[model samples]
Target: MTRTSSAPLRSPVAALLAVLLAASGVLLGAGGAQAAGYRYWSFWEGDGKSWAYATQGPSLVRPDDGTVQGFRFAVSEDSADADRPRHAPDFGAICADTPAKGGAKRVALVIDPGTTEDAPAGEKPPALRTACAQVAPDASSAEALASVAKPLRYDSSAMICAISGYPKSGCGEQVSGDGSKKDGSGKPTDDASASASASSAPAADDGDSGGGPSAGLLLGIGAVLLLGVAAVFQARRRR
Candidate 1:
């Protein structure tokens, strides 16, 4: 009696499954890896009452007279997770001391350097304060900021990275999410008691910057597909 060889058939099936499992892992890792959180200044515009995430960067926005511009530095996944200025956007209170000019516009600016917890290692946050900028009627928000917060720093892409040399270095660096939240909830805390002392600054102007699959991800997918095809071909050949 001749015994049929089952080993050869089992080997190909096992190899095929192994290849498929590896492919699944590659796909999962490519898609599920935790995103790196960013530490950067989030821009905002405020009505007299509340803050709204700025849709346009300061360089592009021509803030109207009495417009309130806000900047907050923090570790956040996106603008939605960013902390708003601690104080309310009271344009009247911020610009009260500065009289209006005939040929210029006045913009109230709020700069929050964030808590020490969110500051870069070995760095401390600057005091939070407001500023009233007197700029040309058509001047952009950036111009308005420069009027008070001079010596502003910007990255190669023209993105505002720092205001008044707070951090001193780095531009939108990636950081872990540990201790990322302020007050346990990523919402704005209305610190109405904070004084509206006049100060000034400039900050980041881009929206959430992201990209598609990386080169490594594409290479991993290609390799997995190739191995799967080879295993299937070998299994059929052994028949």
Candidate 2:
């Protein structure tokens, strides 16, 4: 004679595993949410007269004596690939070092031509600084930098990087050492769509500034699909 036991059957460990895996999938989906529009930095180093691209971000590089650090505003290829072709910056012109005149600080700045439409109205750039300008009549970094009497010497302590928006609210502000500056009315001191952030190095610049969806999203989707497959397997095992 066979006797029936009153004990109930337990669910397989696979069911528990499946729940944890699903929770992990949810967390993975949130990884890239911090991306507030993908603007990043590209670094360069200067020979006191000429410049070269940097292999690593500024944070990894600590300039010794006489070493000059340089940075150029690099937009995403999507933004840069249009008619406006930006050449690598000219260090001799952009980083032109001049002795202080009349005990006033010498500052040099370059503006990108593509960003001219964003420039605010009613304000003119200061005249005393050195600017290396592009030959084109249109607005350009070289053309903007050219107006100044002399380009400021590159400093490891402080660097001038380009910020592309006003109120300085995006990637540029994040990189700015001084942070955002407000006027009497709490409006941003910078009215130009494209402005410079004179800040410290060793902070290192970011990469891949474009804000579009690309390979990363595709890979993420694939991962989610794979996780779904795993959940299906766990369900089958529970049955």
Candidate 3:
């Protein structure tokens, strides 16, 4: 008889850990800030058997040595739909390639930045690609992980529009989450005008900086944590 393997589910502690880590800057929850409506992402991680949703975000997650993290972009509406399946595209399919040029333990970030409605001036329409991936060679440390992961969400640069022809209609100014506009010197110029300026920012033509944790890592961490906790519980019970 063949044994069927079900996908692993995230344990509570693992999930909590991921949220805590992500909150510290490993992942960005700024999906609600996109111009094309808030583009939230669904997180997934894979084990050899099956993939599962993370219990928490990337900033809070510390995956076992070689975990794969996967992300798929969704509009705010679709993202809010709790009934949707937690898995998507597949971690194996996303991270199928061998390491580019390293023997170090690594963590991968597979991001789907999502489609844009704007067509660049004097250029052909952009080809539709699935997603982009970033690999951190030495992912053993939290600092290194943050360095590789934070860019996916936060654009430190003041300029929002990278393309030459794309008119700068939104987010030309530096607006914080509170809608307070910051001057060039980085001070809030207007305390009273707190608008949803962050959401109006145009999509960067450069690369994936959408902030979030990989589902794979979170799931893996959760699994490991769960196992560890279960072992402890069993030992205590026996004692």
Candidate number of the best lDDT: 1
Worst 10 residues of 1 by lDDT: 192-201
> Positional deviation of 79 in candidate 1, in angstroms?
1.7
Q: Which stretches in model 2 have alpha-carbon errors above 4 Å?
A: 1-11, 37-45, 48-71, 74-86, 89-197, 200-239
Candidate 3 C-alpha lDDT tens digits along 105-184: 45544443334422222323223222323344434222233444343332233222222222222223433333344345
RMSD of each: 10.1, 12.6, 22.1
Which structure is stronger by lDDT: 1 or 3? 1
C-alpha TM-scores of all predictions: 0.62, 0.31, 0.32
Cα lDDT tens digits for candidate 1, 1-239? 88677687877678777868777676756544444345667778898899987766677789898899998887765554567889899999999999997998999999898999889888999899899999999999888988888678876445666888877876566554364322232221122001001111122224322223455666777777777878777776766
Give the per-residue Cα lDDT of candidate 2 at 120: 26
Predicted structure with the largest TM-score when compared to the true one? 1
Model 2 agreement with the true structure over 1-239: per-residue lDDT tens digits: 77543232224445555665676556554543322211223344555555555544343443432234433433322212212213333444544655434423332333332233222233222211224322223332222332432343222222333323221322322311122222233211231112222221122224432333335655665776677677657665654
Deviation of model 1 at 8, angstroms? 30
